[model samples]
Target: MRRARTSFGALGAVTSVGVLIALIAACGDDRGGFIKNDRAFETQSEGGAPDAETCLLQCSLDGRSIIDSCTGGVVETCADDLACGAAKCQEPCAAAEADRSSNGCDFYFTQPLSAYPFASCFATFVVNASNKPATVSLELGGEELDVSGALFRAVPNSTDLELLEGPIPPGESAILFVADWDPTIPRSLGERLYHTSCPTAAKPAIQADGYFRSGIGDAFRLKSNVPIGLTWMYPYGGAGTHFPTATLVLPVSAWAKEHVVVNGWEANVGEPVTQIFAAEDDTEITIFGSKDVTNGVGFAGATAGMPAKIMLSKGQFVQIAQSQELTGSLVFSNKPTATVGGSECANLPSKAAACDTLAQQIPAFEQWGSEYVGIGYRPRTANTEEIVWYRMVGGRDGTELEYDPVKPAGAPTTLSAGELVLFRARSNDAFVVRARDAEHPFYLGMHMSGADGEESDSPSHGGMGDPEFVNVVPSGQYMSSYSFYADSSFSEHSLVIVRKKTHGAFKDVWLECAGNLPDWKPIDSAGQYEYRRVDLSRNFGPGDSFGEKRCTTGLQRMRSEGAFSATLWGWGKYASYAYPGGTAFRKLVEIPLSPVN
Candidate 1:
């Protein structure tokens, strides 16, 4: 019983004769007389004749009622006030014929900062969770792009505008290298090569991610099956320096015009940046800045507590960076848009020596959840405790939050709309958070501890881990199965899984690499939910300083009898990346935008 809300435009236009035949065939009654309901067909002509397309569109909008009538061998008359010639009457009549489930089919991608001097080898891992092999393609502004010979390669060079297609087997994944760089070449040399090979009227300065050409900033469309999941990552970065980050790519169906950025790290330690991408033309966006936004164009400089407006078309985007943290900033658009927030390189607690690049696609306020299970990364060493930081942002005014075991020190019990709070916890100290109800949902973020050598006197004691940010998927949005990728570039890869014990024991869960997740621990005394930390691969040590490993162990598939949530993360010497395994992208609320002053 899926409902189609948006206009199909010219795609829905059909010949009047064809529509008439469909209406006649669908409206026939056993008594040889037309079924008529005055309430449903009030908009019919004075002669009691229905408009072909309007009637079909109305029936589609009626959803379950029309289906029920048809199942009971009764055909209810369908009509709408919209004229058949009007654009509103032009709807996809086929929408009512079948249910179109969201397999994460259509989505857009954006690259965050990887820092200068670091090789920006951007790649997206598409996992086919369907039963049938799926074809994957990328497009920008209606033009297909080439990704031939780019599968699983760190650095790929492809010709422009060439349509390249690939298939991903069911329960397996394929890597698409959208942007790549030759690490042997220095940043300056790479920039020169890019400009010489693809010169254009506007030569924008080289980005922190080291992407100097066009199309990198443009939002590219990824088409695939509805059950697929995408994880975007920059596999390589400066050795023993700025680390890379990964984030789950939210599909276009999950996108919204309104979002709020949660503070992941201290702004003073490094530059905090935010980016917005438009999926449609003529999109007007307004940002209510929580901090001063610098290095942005097409809008006036935004000061803290001020508003900035910008316009974008399909595939177009704007990146905004600032010295101050942009947490709690409100982004509103006239059309649905995707927003990403993070830092170029930020130190946790603002005192850790090592900093890592952070990135997470901000979900719409409507998708915020009232319940979340907070789990940290695995311990850096066998003896050391796994310490992590958590940040929660409120999506509504007067949102009240409650913790299952006990609230950590300095955690807030209540928050105003767009307010943010931070707290610390240990890896094994798992807890559940619940708001007053679903109406007062909030966003939760997890941050890995920096490699500050606190565990031992040596500076490299905690060198394998660093500050990284990953959004905590809501418990309600957990899916039963997931196909995700773990970058082989990282020495250690693991998954944090949480499932309801009431539905079934954790033993019911199955992973392609590790069967039945042998390790399970309870979160609280209630015994309703249980969690486990499973290692996919661990080769971190002296020889593997750069976090490189065999590519065969990168893709992973997991399933459970009931809904469960999982987080994929890995770390090596001063490098780490984390993101959710997948999300259902269910709409939980409707958050209105604030009036622009």
Candidate 2:
């Protein structure tokens, strides 16, 4: 027999009187008015406890009051007029409970070791998107981090250290720097002759909690007062000289049973890696390699044109590193899972002077967008135009693509499922991509160019930035507001924004540090949408080297009266990172279930 369960958190607040009236009608009056202690009671009776089943029946009839009273475990307080004698309440009550339990929340990270351990820096920024203040904390391998003192620190210039153990105000954010714990040890006597600090850092433990704990190869469990917007940034690479990247972190509601990783940085220069983390136990996974995966011999012998299989338990992950490109690879699982792909460090155009790490969580095909706006990064110097690389992958065969302001050379007119095309646009160029319709959604990614050997200290270099990868947020997923972070480690930072020209909020859009966004440029002759670039800081060379003293850059907030999309990025000499400001993770497609062998 099924045990009776309380409906405390399962039911949402009742919205209307009509719903209550309808439920009462469904129960009918012929069954008798009220059931008190298993005995019939007068409709006007004010006292006596109602039977559990009967109380639930009345809960559906009187809106929230009686439901709240009964679910609060005070059964005697149930209203007598709720017609608690009904025998038909069990089914609907059970259904409501089942629906609530089905919802889940989990998050994953992809912070692989960089080419040089000393160059690795990982951080996560989270914003309370809800109206209420949010209490946020993190857990790894089942043990919670001491957010109050160990992992979190006060933001840049803010003295409110309490925000670290927040009740962070609505629209505010909490930042976590993994390096705070000191991933490296003090230099030894013998090594002091050759090295200034520890020569190498320790690998993140598979299971542990405390200072020096690495988040690598683990799932991050975020507990918060409400839904949040998250972004992961890995700044500095290659002996702390070059390579940096970032990505928007999708919530568990966006996890799917299938996904296709978009291409990473130039495939020939450095190791291209892909990591898949499971959110459930015994998740069976299959990989259809799009390139000759270098490490294929180990993980089910994955190879180009061949399928590989494996299984992962909750919080466990499998990392695949190779020299070949992993773009177009398909990841399918029996249960929902998350995947992140990129290169440890790569050169743009495959032959650029400097390389940067490229990393972004792959959104499931269900979240692909049918329309996108491509905007390039602001020029490195007032005179030099930055070239941005854009790639689009098809979600369905025969997908037709339309571009405004004249499509560039190499742009495809059509694409087959799992196929992709790459093109280039100048920093000042802004364009729109539209599919035949919502039925032909596609994925879009933007790549930054390398610094081309520009010196960091050159007064005219404008803080030359290197290659980075960022997944473009679809116009369909735009939100009215966003709270993000800009790392001071970078010498310059900026935001690229796109919004409908018809949106009334366009003129009202504002950034926290900067005032109203100005200088909006329309895309081509369409006049349907517009784009703008706002710099948070410009050409400001690195400040204090210590973590706590870097106050020139930190959290940024933006909002509008209507929906809009934005991307946040920052760059230092030979290094850079970029990520979507925020996006809604509505499921846009469905994946058919596959049997596990």
Scored by lDDT, the top model is 1
The TM-score values for the models, in the order shown, are 0.72, 0.71
Across residues 484-508, which tens digit of lDDT does each residue of candidate 1 receive?
6665556776678887542223437
Which lDDT tens digits does candidate 2 get at residues 1-597? 111211100001011000000000000011111222211111111111111323322222221122222353423332322222222233222221211111112355535434433323345566554345656566554456554542243346432333254476655665554322122346445433321111123221111112111111334555554445666555322123355567776656557788886757645566776777676777788877777644332245455766677666555455666666677777888898877767767777676657766777777777677778888877777776566788788877778887887786677889887787878777688887778665677889988777773333222333377778878877655544566666555667777888653222244566665556667788856565688777666555422222232324566666653446778777777778787766655444444322223
Cα lDDT, all candidates: 0.55, 0.53
Top candidate (TM-score)? 1
Error of 1 at 395 (Å): 1.6
| Worst 10-residue lDDT window, candidate 2 | 17-26
Q: Can you tell me which runs of candidate 2 are displaced by over 4 Å?
A: 1-105, 117-119, 151-167, 179-217, 236-241, 293-298, 453-463, 501-507, 541-552, 590-597
Whole-model alpha-carbon lDDT for candidate 2: 0.53
Q: Give candidate 1's error at residue 51 in angstroms.
A: 44
**RMSD from true fold, candidate 2:** 15.8
